[model samples]
Target: MHSRAVFMLLAAFALGACRGPKSDCEGSYESWTGSMAAHDWDSAYELLTPEFKKKVGSPKRMAAYMEDSWKGSKSFEFSPFDIAETNAGVCTARGEMRYTVKIRGELPKDHEQVYFSYVFRQEKDGLWYIELPGNERIQSF
Candidate 1:
């Protein structure tokens, strides 16, 4: 009887561990965006789904691209947020993101604005990853 009780308790703990962190889809996206603002490449990569990292192939490559994209700007920021969920519980999010960068030999800072959307799904592991709505491309900063 004690052994059976122990098994049940372990099972309960396992189930609880499977539950993902308490974060809405938009919140997750914003967390990633915040990482970008701080130029925290590692933190930004951590926010990506494993699938996304696979698609990008390398953290160094993604970080280089992000740096290139923002080279030459000031007061860069992104704002406005929207999130929607499908009947199947999949989520779609849209927002305006901004950035400021200064490139080599540039006299003035450049600001960039992007209107973007992301589709997300809960993996069997109960974690959410960013997936495209239609295309398989995992878009990220």
Candidate 2:
């Protein structure tokens, strides 16, 4: 009986380890930003919540915007900091991005720095997704 109880305890511990920690929300955000910096729009878009997709119009439109905005950029960097949870299933991530753009033939090159705050929602699937700025109540902040 004692050996059986020990086995059960070990099983429980293993199961808990398999479930991982609750910090996946931060991991998701990091993955999303990494995708964006790599110019992998499809992967980045996949990280956005359904509601955000609707507000942004469409996946194609989102990709177009990314392409246009980053056009002619030599390098892009996004540093996410101050990630905190605001409520259940809701978290906010603030960051700054810097990129350099090379202009052709006459126009001077431009270097841009932008500060951003984004909301992320933890869905029923236990994954976090970006909540974009929109008419949605999630954007009230």
Residue 14 of candidate 2: its Cα lDDT? 64
lDDT of 2 at 31: 66
Model 2 regions lying over 4 Å from their true place? 1-23, 56-58, 106-113, 134-141
- Best candidate, lDDT-wise? 2
TM-score of 2: 0.68
For model 1, residues 1-141, the per-residue Cα lDDT tens digits are 999999999986564333322256666566555555666555565556677778777879878876786555456477757676653536667777665555677656454567877676656666555653355444332
Q: After superposition, how far is residue 44 of candidate 2 from its true place, in Å?
A: 1.6
What CA RMSD would you report for each candidate? Answer: 11.5, 11.8
Summarize candidate 2's per-residue lDDT along 1-141 as a digit string, tens digits: 999999999986564333321346787767666666666666667778877777677768888988897777757677777888788888888888787776687564656568878777887888888765443254444
TM-score of each: 0.62, 0.68
Q: What 10-residue stretch in candidate 1 is worst by lDDT?
A: 14-23
lDDT of 1: 0.61
What is the clash count for each candidate, in the order shown? Answer: 14, 0
In candidate 1, position 7 carries an lDDT of 100
